[model samples]
Target: MDSAPIVVHPPTGSGGRRVTVRGEILGLAHSDADVVEFLRRAGLPDAEGLLDDSAWVKWRGGRAHHYEAA
Candidate 1:
């Protein structure tokens, strides 16, 4: 199977940022909005705070990603 893609967003001050890319899991995430929520629940850094400095980072040809939590 393919790994899930990671989306990074800069901080927004509210502590929650934005998910740049969506994941694979439908219940977990498959769209931008769903990805954002998934990260939030995953205990990852708040997306709102990372919105201004985050973005959709992907490999050259790979869909999966490894994000450095800020």
Candidate 2:
């Protein structure tokens, strides 16, 4: 099976959802450029999504897009 490592960092004072793939930072996990491009690169098209808006602690891995609030 093919799998990709997706890491998410909680947003800062004026930042958006930050994510990493294979240990490389990918900007915002909730943005079209970052997270969307990531899913396409990982070949998980249907896994695109946004994270919950309540807390800053979220999932660490998935074909799905995950993020944390600041």
Candidate 3:
């Protein structure tokens, strides 16, 4: 099994609840670059302030995408 870890920091001054976000991606059915590109295309920014744990991962010819949070 292959797993990757990502970290994110929630935005401030958004008038919402604040929280620290940490994500663990396990068993991605593709290369790390592909998975990262997929996440990036799905509006998951590669910056702090984006929800790292709650992002879409599209796989299998872009037919399936799952959202996971931790």
Q: Please report, in order, the local distance difference test score of every candidate based on alpha carbons.
A: 0.40, 0.50, 0.31
The sequence of per-residue lDDT tens digits that candidate 3 reaches over residues 5-69 is 33222222322112121344322322344445544654565732332333422122222222232
Q: RMSD of candidate 3 to the true fold?
A: 13.2
Error of 3 at 55 (Å): 10
Across 2-43, the per-residue lDDT of candidate 1 in tens digits comes to 133454344334333344345532232333455446656756
Error of 1 at 59 (Å): 6.5
- Candidate 3 similarity to native, TM-score: 0.26
- Scored by TM-score, the top model is 2
- The global Cα lDDT (0 to 1) of model 3 is 0.31
CA RMSD, predictions in order? 11.6, 7.6, 13.2
Quick one: best lDDT, which candidate? Answer: 2
Could you give the candidate ranking by lDDT, starting with the highest? 2, 1, 3
How many backbone collisions does model 1 have? 22
Give the Cα error of residue 68 in candidate 1, in Å. Answer: 27
Model 2 residue 61 CA deviation (Å) reads: 14
**Which residue ranges in model 2 land beyond 4 Å of their true spot?**
1-4, 30-34, 49-69
- Overlapping backbone residue pairs in candidate 3 total 0
Candidate with more favorable, higher TM-score: 1 or 3: 1
Q: Estimate each model's TM-score.
A: 0.29, 0.45, 0.26
Off by over 4 Å in 1: 1-28, 48-70
* Residue 64 alpha-carbon offset, candidate 1, angstroms: 12
Question: Deviation in angstroms for 63 in model 2?
Answer: 18
